[model samples]
Target: MDKVEVVVAHAERATLRVGDVFLKVDADRTRLDAEVEAMSLAPVPTPRILWRKPTVLALAALAGTTLGRLGGPSTGSPAAWAAAGAAMRKLHDAPLPPRQGRAGRSVVALTAELDAECEALVTNGVLPADLVTRNRRVAEAALRPWTPAFTHGDLQIAHVFLDGDEVTGVIDWSEAGQGDALYDLATFTLGHEEHLDDVLAGYGADIDRDVIQAWWSLRSLLAVRWLAEHGFDPFAPGCEVDVLRSRM
Candidate 1:
C-alpha cells in the first residue's frame, strides 16, 4: 500500500510484483530437465528485463529503511522502542478471525512432520541430527498443552508493513491457519526480538511460554527444511535463505 502511494505521487514509477521471480527449486537444472522430458511447455514465471526489477529493488530498499527505523536495535532510545512496542502490542491484541478448522492436521502430526524435516536437514549437512532431535522432543513436550487459535504462519519482520510509526499492512497469507497463537508470536519474534516481551505480554493468558518456545523451535526447524526443499530459496519473495539459516 505504501508502495502504491509512492508510485502514485511520483511522475512515473516502475514496479515488479513478487510472482515474477521463479522459485529456486523450479529453476534448478534437475527441475528444468524434468520439465523438458515431460514435454510440457507451460509458461514459467521469470524476471522481466525491464524497469520492474529496478522498481522492486527501490521499493525493497525503502522498506528496509522503514524496518530499521521502527524495528532495528540501533535506535537505542527507550521512547522509540516503547512506541514500537506499543504498536506491536496493539497488533498482537487485535481480534483475529476464528480458526478455519482444517482437517488432517494436529499437534502430534505437525510435530512428526517437523521431526522428519529436521532429519532431512541433518542428512543434507545443514544441521546436526542429534541436536535437532533433542529440540524436537523439547517441542513435543511443550505441545502437550496445545490449544488452537488463529496463527499467521509467517510473521517475521519481512511480513510486516509500517507507515511511519504505525503498522499499515501484513503480507503473505499462504501459511495462515488455525494453530497455537504462540506460533504466530514466535515467528513475529524471530528477527524482531525487541518487540517479543511486550507483544507476548499483551497476548496475556491467550498463550503461554511453553507453547511459544515450541512454536519457535518447530518453526525454525521447518524453515530450514523449506529452504532445503526449495533449493535454499523462498518460493515467495521478501524472505531470503540467509534469514532462514539464521533461524535454524
Candidate 2:
C-alpha cells in the first residue's frame, strides 16, 4: 500500500497524496464544489477527478513538476513560462462557470479590506509600518473597474505544472470564478517578476503594468498574516517579504 504523504495542512483544509492520487479534505463544501466545477469548465488541462465525497476529493496526479516555488526562481525555460501565459489566456477566454458565487470583492470593499489588513500588519508588526504604507498606496491602482473574465483566483506559480517547455496542467481551483484578468497575471508572476515579458509575449495581449504591480503589493500585504498563521514564513529570503521589498 502507498503511504499517505501530507501535502499541506491548515485550519481550513488539508491535502494528502497517496501514490498518484491526491485527496483534498476541506470543511467548506462550497469550495470543493467550486473546484469541481472550475476544473470541468476550464479550457486548459486540469487534474482528473477520480472521485469525490462531501468532505474529501480524490484527484489523479498530473505529469511534470510544478512551474516554480514561492521563494525560488523557476528553473523552467522561457518557453515554459510563455506556455503558462498562453494557458492562462485560454482559461480567461473560457465561458464563465455556472452558479458563480462571490466572484471577487468590489473596489470599495477591496480597498477597505486592504486598509484593515494593513492596520493589522502594522499593529502586529508583521511588516514595517513604512513598507506597509508605501505598498498600500501602490495597491490602489488595482482597485479600479475591470471587465470580468474567467479567473483562476489563485494562479500561483506552484499551481502550474510544466513538461519541459510545455504547460501540462494547472491545479487548485477552489477560488476560481469571474474576476479581473490582471489579477491572475499578477498572482502567477508574484515573486518572479523577471518572467513578466515572456508571459505577456505568450499571452499575446497588452496588460496594464501599473495594475499588475499594484496587485503584487496588495496580494503580498494581504497574505502575510494568513501565511504566518498557516505556518508559512513569508519573511524567508526570496519570499513574499522580499517581493514587497523589491518595490521599495
Candidate 3:
C-alpha cells in the first residue's frame, strides 16, 4: 500500500493540509464538501493554533511532576491521574445510552479478530503458536460477562495534563466513544500504576475491581495484537506472547 503521508501521520479521518485552503478526509468516512473553507486571508494561512495558555502550562507542570516521580521521562503529576479517574467516573456514570449501559457486542467477532491477529504475528515469527491459542482462550473467558462502560479508549500519559496538584486537560478526543471503563483503567494502570492508589481513592468505592482487571487483560492483549500486526514492537518489557497471554 502506498500509504498517504498525511493519512499515516494523522489517525483522525480529517485534517488540514500544509498550505491547502480546506480540510480533507477520507471521503468514505467524511463528506469533505460539507465542511466550510477557512476564514483566513488569500493563502488561507495555516489554521491558527488555539492558544491554550492554561492547558499548555498544565501540560508543562505534568511533564515535570511525572518526570520527577518516574526519575525519568514522564508526563505529569498525580493531579492528571486524579483528573483521569474523575473523567472516567463521570463518563461511566453518565446517563447517556452509549455510555451508561451495555451496548450490543459480539464476543465471537472479538475472538476471531484476536485469533487472526495472533496468527498473523506468529506466522511472522513474532508470536508463539501455543501462546496464541492460550490468548484466544483467555480472551473468550474475559468476554463471558462483559460489562461495557464509557472509556477513554486511549488513556496514555500523553493525554494527561496538570495544573499544580490538579489536572487541567486531557487532549485527543478521537477515541472518545464508549466501550469499557475497565479497559481505560487498565491502560492507565499498565502505563502508570504508580498512581493507582491515588486514582482509585478518588474514583470511590462503587468501582468494580474485578471488572477492571478483566478489562485490563482484554484491552492489553487487544493492544498487543495491533502493535504486533502493525510492526510496532511491544513497549512492555519482555515482548512475548506469554507476557500478553498472562495479562489475558
- Compute each candidate's TM-score over C-alphas: 0.55, 0.97, 0.59
By TM-score, how accurate is candidate 3? 0.59
**Residue-wise C-alpha lDDT for candidate 1, range 141-176, written one tens digit per residue:** 445544555444555555554555444444333344
Q: Give the clash total for candidate 2.
A: 0
Error of 2 at 35 (Å): 0.3
True-vs-predicted CA distance for residue 166, candidate 2, Å: 1.8
Give residue 81's lDDT in candidate 1 (0 to 100): 36
Q: Please provide, for model 2 over 112-195, each residue's C-alpha lDDT reduced to its tens digit, 9 standing for 90 to 100.
A: 989999999999978899999999989999999988889989998999999998888899999999888899999999888899
Model 2 CA deviation exceeding 4 Å by range = 99-103
Cα displacement (angstroms), candidate 2, residue 54, comes to: 0.4
Descending-TM-score candidate ranking: 2, 3, 1
TM-score of 2: 0.97
* Candidate 3 lDDT over residue span 56-156, tens digit each: 21111112222122112445456556665665576566543332212224567666766667677678766566765565555554465556654445665
Best candidate, TM-score-wise?
A: 2
Give Cα-based local distance difference scores for all models: 0.45, 0.90, 0.47
